[model samples]
Target: MGAARAGNGSDGIATNLPEADDYCLTARDIRCVVLDIEGTTTPIPFVTDVLFPYARSNVRAYLVDTYRTRQTMDDVAFLRAQIDKDLADGVPSAVLVPPPSAPEEEVIDALVANVEAMIDADRKLPALKQLQGRIWRLGFDGGEIQGVVYDDVAEALARWHGTGTVRSYIYSSGSREAQRLIFGNTEAHGDLRRYLSAFFDTSVGGKREPRSYYEIWQTLGVDSPSQILFLTDVYQEATAARDAGFEVLISIRPGNAPLPEDHGFQTITSFAQISV
Candidate 1:
């Protein structure tokens, strides 16, 4: 599938549906590119199938092994605070984290239970993502996990970086550390981090919220929102970026969730289609 004309007649939005031609970006004065990870640069299956499972299955051992370390203690404290709020707000599957004085096994068990639940629910809380990033760090360092990206990603990143005008960034729900770990350890590319200028996560704001894009635009220090191009696989995200005045493109990738029929956004199957 190529670019699908968005039905919504927003001013400056592309409305031409090209059957065979890829959506061209050369016409736009895009100075910065903000990319989404899951379902856009990386396959959804790599996250849902491999990454999540690795974190879920190894969380217990990780907690047990690192229990007394300062980092683990901080992680536990953060999760405890989050779970306390969740329980107060009546969030389902929110488990009680035992106190630090509790038996080590008991504390580890409670933390693991809550972590697994968060993983299953795919919660975007900073506590959860921070812990997951640390866990994945071990796996990546040990050569147990290798980051996976679309074949077109590394080349496009290189091309954009080579231009000296278009800067590339990643804005994902994944913590910035996790984003680095993924891009820094890819098998085929072998350290794509050099091409990325910076990373943004939930600390900025939720991806679907327009204000998040506004925050990113300000941080990028670009001439205008129109100077940035946001690529994502979800319609809501594309809409959010567009509302923030950034040009948007919806990525069409295998195993990605279906978009609404009337979701009026240009779509691209490969980053190679995008010209800086």
Candidate 2:
């Protein structure tokens, strides 16, 4: 199905769809490359199937076992931070939860329900991400979870970093720690963690927000945002990167990607399609 089938569709031309000829990188422009996990460098299921389920099955227990404990309060605080951050970033309140028309109790209930639902969806909801960070922390400590990155990731990282072609990093809604765990424990990758320079998560800013991309550039000591090529499967995020002045490429894995939209950036079917 084309993007039109998604219901919230846009004409392909309205978004910038680049031809292969338009893209040129002779392993010179990109001094640093930041990656988005699902749909980009790795499969969506690796995160949704492996990471999400690990966190979900453990969140309640982790909460119950730790409720009122320092960590629980910290998780709540992190979620609250995400909420306030979104509001400050101009994400409409309605998208998360419209202010209740009813009493205070109803509003509180709606808020909790909204957060929980986002959690269930493995969404990037601030609350869910905070909880994911916490759950993964526990899982990692207990040896119940090992982060799962893709087979291609290690080879790609080695090639990029070994040749001094570009520095590699990750940006995901998953906690920075979770991102590290996944990449660090790729079944064959060994500890590829040393190859990365930094990781950013929702705690920094929503992925769809241009400011987050700006922050990433700032962290990398790259004053020019356009100097970096950000690979992501999500068009909104790629839009955010391009809006922030970074180069953008959308990766479409099989059974992944929501049709194709330049979404104000370039699009690719795989990392192999990208020319460093």
For all predicted structures, in order, the TM-scores are 0.92, 0.74
Candidate 2 stretches greater than 4 Å from native: 1-28, 80-115, 141-143, 260-264
Judge candidate 2 at residue 224 and give its lDDT: 86
For residues 146-219, what per-residue lDDT tens digits would candidate 1 score against the true structure?
Answer: 99988899999999888888899999999999999999999788999999999999999999999999999999
Model 2: per-residue Cα lDDT over 158-215, one tens digit each: 7677767588888888778778777776665567888887887877799999998888
Among the numbered candidates, top lDDT falls to 1
Which residue pairs collide, candidate 2? Answer: none
Provide the lowest-lDDT 10-residue window in model 2: 1-10
Where is model 1 more than 4 Å wrong at Cα?
A: 1-21
Candidate 1 lDDT at 239 equals 94
lDDT of each: 0.88, 0.67
